[model samples]
Target: MALLELEGVTRRFGALVALDQVAMAVEEGEVRAVIGPNGAGKTTLFNVITGTVKPSAGTIRFAGESIGGQPSHHVCRLGLSRTFQITALFPEMSARENARLAAQARHARRWQPFGGAGVFRQAAALADAALEQLGLTSIGDTPAGLLSHGDQRLLEVAMAMAQQPRVLLLDEPTQGLSVEETAQAVDTLARFLQASRMTVLLVEHDMEVVFRLAHRITVLHRGAVIADSTPDAVKADPAVQDAYLGGFA
Candidate 1:
């Protein structure tokens, strides 16, 4: 069985049909890219999977158990995690502090009673490890609010790693980053997934990142999956070229 499965999942906002029986399956330790134009329900799907939103129909099964209606915290505690498109960091805290906080959360030990233990020890080590992996170690001590825009983006990703989730959901992780920053982020993520064998689902407009990292790509158009195939196959689909590339048709 696949590690994650969504069958006939649907969500609605008044008259808006955000997801129309969108079905997807993610196997263990694979990267699946969900690509589409704006308002295509990509983020909504992420929210649903991560428990930020509930589906109006169908079922969601993770590791063979139903999880469609659980709260987000419940979902996170169950080994699923996500990073926002917007950098969600504690601006007042230094980057190292933020990462330490996340690592502390991951320990899931009696430390929970202490408010925020593990901030200065191995938590710091985990933070430094994550920062070094993402090439953010140089600015590790800087306040998140003071870093450059691209560094802020990388920090959000590092924070997500703090939890060390098995299933990682990233929403527009490379948004607003320069080409060089984008490449760096991609290379960093490639190394992480390759070594950690984490299952990743990324929502992005950048086809290059999708094509580069994803083993299978699903195209969402008008709240429905128009195609699901390997990167090369999806790129060659005439409909994908027409809808995604426009006049490149």
Candidate 2:
């Protein structure tokens, strides 16, 4: 079975249909990109998958089990993790500390009367490993708010990686980055995914990044899927061209 699957997923906010019968399947270790025009429901889809928003109809399956309507924390614990479009980090915390917190969330025992030093140490080690992998080890001591915007974005990704997830959901990861920063972010993310063999569902506006890293692309229009195909096929599709890519090209 595909690692992640959504069957006829629909989400509505009263009169507004944010998503309409959206169906998608992300296979193991594949990087799938979701793209569409503004208000096409890309973020809404992520919200539903990550359980920030519940679908009004249809089911979501991860690793062969149903997970639709599960709480965000529960879904996260089940090995699906997400990073938001806006970087979410503890501004006052150091990069290492932020990463350590995420790592601890995966392994810490809630029953512990007092936070154990051993657990903290283990989480710190994991944080260091993730930081090293992302080439952020040198800046691990820097405050998150003090880091450059691109570095902060990369740090947010490291925090997600620290979760030890089976699938990662990224929303506009390279948004607001400069040309050089965007290129760096894409290269760094691509290397990490390839090295770790991680499955990813990404929402992004940068067509270059999407074309560079995605194994396939799914296009959405007015809350419905318009195309799902390989990068080359998607680029050549007339419907996709007319809906979004024509202006992009």
RMSD in Å for all candidates: 2.4, 1.6
> Candidate 1's residue-wise lDDT over 63-147, tens digit each?
9989997998777867787889777889989998888887776665645554553434667777888787677888888999998
C-alpha lDDT of all candidate models, in order:
0.84, 0.90
Candidate 1 Cα outliers beyond 4 Å, as residue runs: 105-110, 113-125, 247-249
Misplaced by over 4 Å in model 2 are: 109-115, 247-249
Superposition TM-score, candidate 2 onto the true structure: 0.95
Report lDDT (Cα) of residue 217, candidate 1: 89
lDDT of each residue in 136-244, candidate 2, tens digit only: 9999999999998888888988888888789988999998899999988888888888898889999999999999889999999999999999999999999999999
Clashing pairs in 1: none
